[model samples]
Target: MKIAVVGATGLVGRKIINLCEKYFDSDVDYSFFASSKSAGSELEINGNKIIVQELNDDNISNFNISLFSAGGEKSKLFAKKFLDKGSFVIDNSSAFRMMEDVPLVVHGINEEIITEKTMLISNPNCTTMGLVMALKPLHDEFTLKSIFPTSYQAVSGSGTKAVTSLEEEIGLGDDLTPDYSDGFYERPIAKNVIPLAGTLLENGYSDEEMKFVNESRKILSIQNLIVEPSNARVGVKTGHGTFCSALFENNVDVDEAINLISKFEGIEYWADRLATPLDAEGQNDVLVSRLRKGLSNDKILNFWVVSDNLLKGAALNAVQIAKHVSTL
Candidate 1:
């Protein structure tokens, strides 16, 4: 079988390429594609050097699956092309995520929605991927009512450019000036936090914030679920952290909630210490900690979650979806 890794030169795309070797059989053939600028550049896969091809109509070919992480625009342009070629498109972009016909999947949370008939799958936002992983097990046991989540997302979510920008800005330590000349973020992000993560809508919520609301509801299959989202971009490089205050229909036992998260698939629970972004840097599982009852009600629970934004949040989940569909 053959597989295509679209956006192969990108941050998440590279992760997907690295993971393809781990998840797929060694015999499977792999092709890498990037933009014209990155095309002709070489990348190593399974110890063999492969030239990155330009993602265009001429390069498009029949493959069992195509993993996409370029951007929404690229996905919108190229995904259907792959689908028409009888390939399953696992997209890691905002494109087609909320579409009724497309399934927005988080690996362990809602992967069962994928079937033999499924071809196009959308991976959730990096922040939502971490948030929902911690919430799903608790939501199943207690019936989630509402969630107020504040995300401390890393600059890596914006891709390699943002990561470089953060590093460059950090080199100017204590400059205390907003310089938009280098970074992908609107404001300075070296040692400061940007209040908004995505384009702000008329409703005063960012597109990233609403992704937490809409994608969580869609993935969890709770149409009326309430989500109050506030997302911020932090100075970290890899992991995305979220602080969630959730209310459930039933009273939650702190012990039981901790136990539930501990045993849940793709999650690691820390009982004695809080999980930090640095701790979650290379982890495949969502790191969850600080579980406790809310001050006001026993039915409310508060916790912190962290995950490698590039891994479980984007590329890892996309590859996992492809692996699952390959089995089907």
Candidate 2:
């Protein structure tokens, strides 16, 4: 089988390449693509050196599957080109996610939506991906009525420049007098938290916050499900954390919920200790802790979820979808 990895030099793209080796067979043919600026660079895969090609109309190849993380604009231009070549396009961008026909999938949760005829799939936002992974299992058993989530996301989710900005801010030591001239974020991201993570819309919610509401409802097949979301950018570098409170139609049992979360694939439940972003930095599974009954009523349940935004949130989810298509 032949596979293509676009945006091969990016933060998420590099992780996807690393995970392709882990999830796919050794003999599968792999091709890497990047923007013209990053083109001609070489990446090692399976004991061989592979050169990254410039992503353009001329370089589109006939492959079995193509994973795109080059951003929405590039995906809008190139995804269907790969699709017309008879390739399955699993996009890791916001481009095709909300389209009625495109299946927005989080691999292990609702991947059954993918079938023989479905060719283009969209991976969810990194924060939404981790949030839904924990919510799916509970929603199935308790029947979710509403979701209230506040996300604490890391700078890595904003790309390499944001990560560099955080590092630069941290380098100033105890002095907070540095000019905010060159930073990517609106506020200092070193020892601070920004309440708004994405572009603010007319409705007063950021794009990232709406992704949690809209994408989760679509993935779970709940069109009118009530969701109130807030996203904050934190000082960390890897994991994305969410403190979620959900209301269920039926009564929730804490023991049964823990049991269900533990058995679900790609999730780890912590009953004895609290799970934090530090513990979830390099793990493939979403970490859940501090599960308890909400103070308002018996039907409400609250929990904390964390995961590696680069791993399970982005690259791991995209590659897993490709693996599923390969089996068919």
Candidate 3:
């Protein structure tokens, strides 16, 4: 298989290259693509140096599959160009996720919907990916009535620049105000929590919070499901942790729900132990723990979920989509 990784120099894109080499057989051929600023740079893959090429229509059309992690604008501009050339694009951005034609996919939850014609599939936001993976199995037994989620997302979710900002701030003394070079974040992300992730919409919700609410319903195939989400930026470097309190349609046995949740694919249940961001870093599976019953409703349940935002949230999901495509 010939694979091209767009945005090959970014955090998520770099992780995708590593995963493809780690999981796929030695026979697979891989290529790297990046912006003109990063062109001609060499990326080490499987102990071989692969030169990164500038992404353009001509170069993109040559690959059988292209994994895009660059951003909404880059995806909006180049996705169709790659698809028009008969290449399958597994996008890790929110650009095409809610589109009527594009399928927002998570391999363990909805791998069956994937087909050869599915040229551009969108991976859900990192926070949403973890929430849905933990909720889907229970939603199957008892439909999800409503969800209230609070996320403690890592600085890495904002990309490489944010990571640099945090490191620089830490290096400076506490009294020194962290300088915002490109205005990456509204506030200093070191030793502080920012209540917002994405821009605030007209509805008073940040784009990140709305992504969890909207994408979860779309991926789960439930139109009227109610989701109340509050997104926060924590001091963590990689993993994203979400605490969800959900209500179901019909009363469900707590033990059965726990058992069912434990069996859900891509999720590891830790009933006695609590899952943390440090534990989830570099892992592909969503770690779920801190399960509890809601006090108000017997049908409601609360739980905690965590996963590597760069892996299951982005790179690993894109790689899984490619694996699905290869099987077809």
Candidate 4:
């Protein structure tokens, strides 16, 4: 199989390259594609030096599959170009995710929706990816009435620059000045919490928060699923934690829910230990812990979920989508 990775210079892009070497068999061939400024550079993978090429109209047909982690604008502009050239574009951006015709997919949860003929696949937001994985098995049996989620997201989700901002402001304990340079936040991220993650849209919900609601609805195939989410940017460098209090249609027990959740393929459920963001870093499974009864409602329950935003949430999901395609 011939694979190409757009945005090869970015963090998620690098992770995807690493997975190709880790997951794919020795028959796989890779072509790294990035912007013109990074065209002449090289990306080292599995002891091999792969030259990065400039992404353009002329070179779109060079692979059987292309993984894109550039932002939404870049995916909007170029994803279909790869498809037009017979490449399965597994976009890791939000660009095509919400489109009605486009299939928004996670590997084990909703992967059956795609086949060899599926030309374009949209990867869910990193937070949404982890949240839905935990929600699926429960929703499948008890049927979810509603979801209330609050996320403690790592700075790395905002990109490499946001990671730098957190590193740069580590010792600025009391300096409250805004660090709006390359970071998503308009305020200091070190020792401080920003209530926002993505840009605030017209509806007053930050784009990242809305992703939890929208993507959850689609992947679960529940058109009317209700979700209320709050996304925050924490100082941590990786992993995203989602704390959700849910209401089900039936009265449920914690042990029963854990058993159902354990039956799901991509989630690891533990009742004895608390799952932290750090626990999920560099790993592929969504970790579920802190399960308990919710207040004020017999049908309600609360649980904590965590996963590596860059790995299981983004890069691994994209690679798994391609792996499904490979089976076709």
Which 10 consecutive residues of model 2 have the lowest summed lDDT?
175-184
lDDT of 1 by residue, 120-231 (tens): 9999999999999999999999999999999999999998888888989888887648755556788888888999998999999999999999999999999999999999
Sorting all predicted structures by TM-score, with the top scorer first, yields: 1, 2, 3, 4
Q: TM-score of predicted model 4?
A: 0.95
Worst 10 residues of 3 by lDDT: 175-184
Residue-level lDDT tens digits of model 2 in 277-314: 89998899999999999897999999999999998889
lDDT of 4 by residue, 60-140 (tens): 765799999878888988987888878999999888888888899999888899978889999999998898898888887
Clashing pairs in 2: none
Query: lDDT per residue, candidate 3, 75-136, as tens digits?
Result: 99998888887789999989999999889998899978888877789999988998899889
> Candidate 1: where are CA atoms >4 Å away?
179-182
TM-score of each: 0.98, 0.98, 0.96, 0.95
When superposed on Cα atoms, how far off is each prediction in RMSD?
A: 1.1, 1.1, 1.7, 1.8
- The alpha-carbon deviation from the true structure for residue 266 of candidate 1, after best TM-score superposition, in angstroms, is 0.7
The true-versus-predicted C-alpha distance at residue 36 of model 4, in Å, is: 2.1
Model 3 per-residue lDDT at 100: 90
